[model samples]
Target chain A: MKYDCDACGPELGAYLLGESSDETRREVDAHLAACTACRDELERERALRTALGDLPTATCPGAVTARILAVVDAEYAATRRRNRRLRGVGLAGGLLAATLAAVLFLRPGAALRGASAEHYTPEQVATARHELIQTLTLTARVLDQAGRSTLVDVFNDQLPSAVEGSLRPLDDPTRGG
Target chain B: MTNETFHELLATHRDRVFTQALFSLRERRDAEDVTQEAFLRLWRQGDHLPADRVAPWLAHVTRNLCIDQTRRRSAARRHLGVADADAVDGLVAAAGGPDDPFAGLDLDDRQRRLLDALQTLPAETRTVMLMHYGDGTKLADIADAMGKSLAAVKVQVHRARQRLRLVLGTADGVSEQRGSA
Candidate 1:
């Protein structure tokens, strides 16, 4: 196959880099043989590659390497700590859940006995109900008194100043006159 | 690979990654930061990565970090009037180093011209070129890392070579004329 320079121009790097397939290499070779421009271009590419490839390998500073390792270490440690905390929390939660489940399943009557009517007789139940009502009524009275006290304080704080301002004239002429 | 082998790989490629970042970002501190980020990323993902993909993976991550840094630098420049003094100082310092790869080599006139010309290329082009030539990374790998098509990378590389050749050729002609005189 005949090779055109325009078509073959882009393949030059591939050819020099040995990335070109055999067939493409042959095509490039044929094109290069027939074209001086491409030939010169190829030589220049070769020179550039050689010059660039010959650049000495540079090493990162020792301190920079140490810093990188330190950062990685710190980050890894943090990750481990986070994972461990999560695991601890998860394990504790699991244990607690499991214990509760086991107790419910094994002593099925524990929940019932705590709130069961069997634990209290009729007289004791009536007395307990009466005590509960009394406690609730006292609590309600205390809350109502607290609310009234707050309102009284607010009114007392504002009333004297409000009355004084209302009785006083807006434009006092005694001092100015 | 085990921790030992991973460390070995890190030691082996440390300079390559640093040099690539240094050239790409044009600042030593930024390069170091990018290098650290890349290695840290590698360590985190190392277990899931294939052995062969390690080097290119580092290259890809480092380049991305450099690009991000460049964007940040530009933004900071715009908003805070922050200039890249570090980049200039880094190049100047690197120019004097006896062990600096770009400077230390006993290159000929043409090679030196090529090196100087390389600095003048766009950051992305110079990066791809350097990674390919300096580290011997494949174009396809560079493309994959940079999220570019292979063809695009090749084109950038081609343009870089073409520019360097022209610059070197011009320098060669002037030197030849002087020699003849």
Candidate 2:
């Protein structure tokens, strides 16, 4: 190839390391054969490398290796933990879905209307409608146990208030009577 | 290789690895951390590593880690506040004539002094020099690592060396050489 213009000086270090491509190595060899300056440069470089090697190395402490091993172990453990959690979530979700399916199919009539309708005043019907809408709204947003727990707590705290408010207006709209 | 063999190899090459890391990081603790991280990564990828390429592989990994560390540090609060004198010197000394034993000098003091003279070169040239001599990285690898062009790396190498010679001349109380890069 175009040996004269193509650069080999950049590959000199790799050449010394014997990591250069065969073609580049050949060019370097030929160049060294003819170029005394490049040859001298290579010698100084080699000597300098030896000297650099001779320069003192930092003393790694006893804990360094231990610390590294510990980190690797910890990472491995964490990955396993995450996988197990995901699997547990999947299993729980499957069981919940199956339970819901059984409830719907095994006893559809009763399960669908456990709190059956009975006689009620307009205020009671209004309260029931408000409670039903509120419960449905809460259940619709409950995506997880944690969120469902919070939703249940919100309904528990609000149903009584909502029911009271719904009938209070029918009984007496006045703030104080 | 088995763990024992790997550890033995590491123990054998620890000095070089640590030295390279130290020079790259310029901090003792950082060097140790990088060394361990590099080896740990090596171990994690051990199955893929061919045995013959271990030392150079370690060097290459350590060098890349150092470069990454430097880049990361350069971004955040300076993890290594220490200026990189080694990178400058690596390229400075990486390509001397193969026959000349460091400018034909037998004295270690003169050699050390000459190297120290590299400090005065322009910062960019010094970096190129360090990659060559300090890390023994090929010019192309140096260019790749430093994100510089081959021509740029060559010019930097040539200029850095020429400047280093002049600086050494000045350091040795001699006149600046009238030579070109």
Candidate 3:
């Protein structure tokens, strides 16, 4: 187990740093025992480590920390502002959809009752159908603008089923009379 | 991350990041700039990084920013036709000034020589030494943070020691003996 200076020289740093494995340490230890030069080099490495450890720690200046935090704060503020705007758009879309639902189903003599009552004319039925389509289109556009266009997919699926019977009189002009 | 949590992270790791940048760049202004930039990046990506990995992530980013700063400086020197002397010379010249981080420290002859010699090593080598010695980071962790193999990190450490010894004029006898053989 004769380790030459060339092989042992590189291990000395890892040895001094305590990063060498057990077998490598044993090998380096054997070389250091027989080799005075390698031992001296190891001592120098140890001294170098000591000197490095003794060097003063550098502190980050206050101004730098302040600048970093300020930038982060500004970014956070921007994100919050964007979120608030989107939320406002979402609220508007929700109100529009709710109103559309109430007008078609809740008003006295509304389209739902008028479909069975035989009191409304064909012109009135056509007008209600056109207004419903326009309101639905506008609500879809508003939701899409708010980046919640997926909600429009839900609206598309549910609204047509609920309103189809009320608007069925459009297919038979005489049914409205 | 919340503002308070981000501030906590800055308080915890600022000095280490700044110290590493100083070791790699050898200029207090550049180090400060790099540190600020590194923390800003951490603030942006903190959500994706695990709490355990935050320190290593910061170390990796700081090291990269320092290397980039060093290269830009070198390129500027080359473009200006200015001879790039050892980086330590600049520190030594500004040692007692207001902006020098090491201004008020009491460094002895050997320590001073070692500090100067350290700046002459490549940025990556110097970074490995600083992480291992200055911050007491493990070699395996250093390898992980730097995205390098453990063997490569060990080799850099060894090269740093050899170069420092050579610069300090303490390796002449053994080096000569080995050179002949």
- For residues B87-147, write the lDDT of model 3, one tens digit per residue: 5446656786346446555665555666778889887788778777776677788788888
- Candidate 2 residues A110-157, lDDT tens each? 333454455345655565455445433333332243222333443464
**Candidate 2 chain B worst ten-residue window by lDDT:** B172-181
- Candidate achieving higher DockQ, 2 or 3: 3
**Model 3 per-residue lDDT at A12:** 72
Which candidate has the highest DockQ of all?
3
TM-score of each: 0.66, 0.46, 0.69
DockQ of 3: 0.28
DockQ for every model comes to: 0.21, 0.11, 0.28
Rank by lDDT, descending? 3, 1, 2
Candidate 1 CA-lDDT value: 0.67
Candidate 2, residues B31-65: lDDT per residue as tens digits? 78788988788767746866656665676678777
Q: Is the docking of candidate 1 incorrect, acceptable, medium or high quality?
A: incorrect
lDDT for residue B2 in candidate 3, whole number 0-100 = 76
Residue-by-residue lDDT tens digits, candidate 3, A83-164: 7656756765676779677667764345546366566777667776765665566555555545642344334643444345
Better of 1 and 2 by TM-score: 1
Reference-based lDDT, residue A87, model 1: 56
A57-77: candidate 1 lDDT, tens digit per residue: 556889988887777667667
* Interface RMSD, model 3, angstroms: 6.5
Return the top candidate by lDDT: 3
| Over 4 Å off, model 3 | A1-38, A86-120, A123-127, A130-177, B78-101, B171-181
